[model samples]
Target: MKKIIIIIITLVLFGSCKKDEPAPIVVPIITSINPIQGNPDTEIAINGSGFSTVVSENIVKFNGVVAKVSSATSSTLIAKVPISSGSGLVEVSTSKGSANGPSFTYIPDIFVGGIESNGSKFVGKYWKNGVAVNVTNGTNNVTIYSIAVSGNDVYLAGYETVGSVKVAKYWKNGIENILSDQSKDAFCYSIAIDGTDVYVAGSEFNGNQYVAKYWKNGISVSLTNGQVSAEAHGIAISDGNVYVTGQEALPAGPLVAKYWKNGIATSLTDGKYDASAWSIVVSGNDIYISGYEDNGVNYARYWKNGLTNALSYNGNNIVDQIDQIVVSGSDVYVAGRQSKTALYWKNGIAVPLTNGSNLSFAHSIFLYGSDIFVAGNEFNGTAKVGKYWKNGSAVNLTNGFFDCSPWGIIVR
Candidate 1:
C-alpha cells in the first residue's frame, strides 16, 4: 500500500511538471506596417509579435535587402527603408521565425524642363509627373532653358524669337511675362524666385554688345557695362541677395567665368582661358558655381566660394562640362556630361549614369531624401529623347520617336 501511494504521487508530480512546461515556440506574426508607402530612407514602424528585444538580432528587409533597424522590442520595431528598395513586401525575421507584412510602395513626384516640337516650331514645355504642360502657345520658336517651382507656382525662363530678335521672357503658370523690350535681341537662361519677387537672369543686346543682366520683378540690373559681351546662365537668391553666374567675353581675350552678387561682379577666373559658369546655388553662406575651364582642354570644374575643384575625364582631349548644381545639407551635387556621357558629381566624386555607346547629357539634378534624380536627354540611335534617371534607372519622359531635351529639373 505504501509503494502504490508513492508511485501514484510520483506520477502525479511528473504530470504536473509536464503541464507547467512552456508550449512550442511561436513564429513571428506581422500584422501591419505603418505608412505602407514612401521613398527610400523613410522610417517605418513594424508591429508584430515574437520579435527579438535586441535590435541587431531582428532583421528587417524591403524586398530581400536588409534594412537598418533603429530599435526593436519583443513586439515592435523601427526600421529605415533601404535606399535600393522599390515597391515590395516588408519582411521581418527573428530567431523564432520570419513573417511578411503589407507591401510598401515608393513613388516620388518629378518635374522636367525641355522643349517639344509642334510640327513647325519648337515650343517650350515642362512635364510634371510625366504630363506635359505648354509654356508657350507655339506661335514662335521658343526655347526653355530653366524651370523653377515654388509652392503651386511654376516658372520657366527662356527666349522666343519675335521678328528678327529673340525676346527674353519667362512664363508664370503658362502666362508670359516679357523681361526685355523688343528693341534688341535678348534671351533669359535662368529663373529664380524669392517670396513675392521674381528674378530672371540672361543676356540682352544693347546695340553695342551682349550685356549680362538680371531682372528682379521686371526691373533690370546690368552686371556688365554693355561694352563687353557677357551672358548670365544661372540665377539664385538667398536672404535678399541675388546671385547670377555666367561668362564675360573680354575684348580679344578668352571668356572669363564670373558671378555677380547683388549686381557686384566677381571674377572666378582670369581671361587667359575660356571658362563659363552655367549654374549657381547658395547654401547657408557658402556659394557654389558649376562650369568648365579650358586648361588646354575643356575640363569640368566647379567653384565653392571661389575655390576651384576639377573633375577627371577618361583621357586627353575629352571635353566635360557641368550644367547644373544643387546643394542639399552638406552634400553638393553637379550634373553634366563627360565626353558625351551623362554623369553627376557628388562632392567631386564622379558617378557615371550612362555608358559611352551613345551621346548622353545630364543637364539638371535634384535630391529628394536619399534619392538622386537627373534630368537630361539621351540619344536612342535615331533621335534624342527627354528622360530622367532615378538612382541610375532611366525613365523616359518622351518617346524615342521625337527629339527632345531636358534642361532643368525640380522635386518637391
Candidate 2:
C-alpha cells in the first residue's frame, strides 16, 4: 500500500513539473520610432510589444548617442531624445535582438502642413513653433479631401454629412461654408490658394448628372454644368489660370482623362480605355497631371505637356494611382502606391521606398530645399503603422501602437 501511494505521488509531481516548465520567451517587436525627431531631451516614443521586461541590459540610441529611458509600458518605451551627432537611422538594441527606426534632422517647430485621408475621413495634426493645431475640429462625420494654407487662415474642402446626405462644403479657418448648398451628393477634392482668394475644384450633382465645378472666394462656377458626368479631383492655379483634371464618362462606356485650363476642357487620352487623373501641377504654364490608365492592365501614368508616361507596366496589375505631385526646381516628383508598395517617381523614374516587403504606401510628398520627404504607411499583414521616407530610406513613425498613417508632409 505504501509503495502504491508513493507511485501516485510521483505521478502527480511529474505532471506539476511539466506544467511549470517556462514557455519560450517572445522577443518584443520594435515596429517603429519617430523619424523627424524633436529637440534634445525630447521624449522618444517607441512602439511595439514585449518592452515591459527591458530593464538594465536593453539600450536605445539615436545617431550613436545613448538614450535614457523614461518609462516603459508593455509595448512602448519613452526615452529622452539624444542630440544627433550625425545623419543616420535611429537604432535600438536588446539582449535578444536589434531594430532600426527612421532618421531625423534637427529643425524648428513642425510647420503648418497639409491634411490627408485615411480610408474614410481625413485626419492629421500639425505644429508651428512646437504648438499643435487641431486638424479634425473634433468631428468624424465629415470627409476632408484637400487643404491649402495662406498666411494665418487655413482652407479645407470636403463633404459634410447633413442628415443622411453628404453635401460638399468648404471651411475657412474651420468655419463651414455652404457654397453649393445641395441636398444631394457633392464633394470637394482639391484646393489652391492665389493671394487672398481661394480656388476649389470638385463635383456636384445637378438633377441627374454630376458636373465638375470650381469655387472662388465662396462663389461656385460650373465648368460643365450638365453636359456629362464629369468629376474634377485635382486643382491648381498658376499666373491666374486655373487648371483642373479628372475623368469624363463618355456615352461609349469609356471614361477619358480630361483637364480644364480656365474652363476649357481638353481630353488627354485617346479613348482606348478608362483613365482618371489624381493630381495636377503647373510649371510655367506647362500642366502636368499624374494618374493611371487602363490599357488592358492598370499602369501608373502621368501627362506632361500633353505627353503620356507610364511608371509601371509589368505585372497583371489592374490599378495604380498617383496621389500627389510636387515640382522642385527642375525635378518633378510624384508619390503614390503601387502593388501596395510606397512608390515615388523622380522625373518619371520609379523608386520604391520601404523597409521591407511589408505593405507600404506613399500618400504625399514634400520638397524642402534639396531633400525629399514621402509620408505613407507600413503594414505587417494586420496592423499598419505610419511611415516616412527621406531620400529613399523608410523610417517607422508610429512605433506600432494603435496604428498611424501620414497623409501630408511639410517643413517649416
- TM-scores for the candidates: 0.74, 0.66
Q: What tens-digit string does per-residue lDDT give for candidate 1 at 177-281?
A: 998988999999999989989999999999999999999898899999988889998999888888999999979968999999888889999888888998998
Q: What is the C-alpha lDDT of each candidate?
A: 0.87, 0.71
Which structure among the candidates has the greatest lDDT?
1
Q: lDDT, candidate 1, residue 23?
A: 93
Index of the highest-TM-score prediction: 1
Task: Please give, for residues 1-412, the per-residue lDDT of candidate 2 as tens digits.
Answer: 9999999999999999999999876565777775455765567678876665545555877778787887777677787666433345666677667777677555522233333344555454443433545556535556656656664566667766666676887777767777667677888888888998888888888878888888888788888867678889899988888899988888777888889988998998877898888789898757888887888755677788889877762343543557888887678888977666678889867778864478777877877656787877787666676666778876665455444555555543
Please count the clashing residue pairs in each candidate, in the order shown.
Answer: 0, 2
**Which runs of model 1 end up more than 4 angstroms from their true locations?**
1-107, 315-317
Error (Å) of candidate 1 at residue 106 is 8.1
